[model samples]
Target: MTASPERQMELTLPMVPDIEIAAARAAGNLAREIGMASASIDEMAHAMIEACINAREHSGSQDRRIYVKITGTSLGEGNSRIDIWITDHGRGFNVTEARSRRQQLGAVHKRGWGLQIIEAHMDEVSITTSDDGTTIHMVKYGKNDD
Candidate 1:
């Protein structure tokens, strides 16, 4: 069955590489506290870090501000899902084009692997872009109900 939406928590941080790790850790911890497995927490954290990095790095400036929002919900009877959204205010690029660029650049170096990694780990992933900014929505499933 399709997952359901629930409460949301939002965070805004300076678009700097140094802060991404911290943000990921905090998010992961929160996820775990809410019933996600350790591995799932790690995976979600990694995905969040990657998404934020892409927003800060390729989106625009090193000083740009990125907004992160997470929502958690109980699925079925014992399952839960968390949705994380990372947004950036910059000139957005096409997801398809971005993948092509990354493929040409290769994943060994600084290629566009964030989306792929996020997709690999998260239960759901969606991207919305406009002149104002771009937002990435990622969903992670947990082990139990609320």
Candidate 2:
């Protein structure tokens, strides 16, 4: 089978209420075009929303903007995958330390579950953070992927 060219979309959003919905909608549309299952598309949208909200609230970026990139790559035989990267230029925090603190806080807490939600929804998740900023990378496989 021949490989198809990757499809990509990028969005920059000012840190504002209800803006995350636009990002989620764009992600859902791309996932659908890539032949991702409806359920997976919904999950991806949810993850996207959470990621954006997390960045907006916690990133502390002076620019007050969120950057999102979505890439869809064909895996041949009707299979495909979508990768999403969410970035914020702000003071960063240690992921490990944050996770530990969240664990201590427990599920009883109503907030700070964005990371957990994103991880639960996406097939693969990774994070990079430094004093400069934080970027979250997430991927979800298409319906036909084994």
What TM-score does each of the candidates earn? 0.82, 0.88
TM-score of 1: 0.82
> What lDDT score goes with residue 42 in model 2?
83
TM-score of 2: 0.88
The regions of model 1 sitting more than 4 angstroms off are: 1-7, 61-63, 101-110, 144-146
* Pairs in clash, predicted candidate 2: none
| Candidate 2 local distance difference test against the native | 0.86
Poorest stretch of ten by lDDT in candidate 2: 97-106
For each candidate, the alpha-carbon lDDT, in order, equals 0.78, 0.86
Q: Go through the candidates in order and give the C-alpha RMSD of each one to the true structure.
A: 3.4, 2.9
User: Model 2 Cα RMSD, Å?
Assistant: 2.9
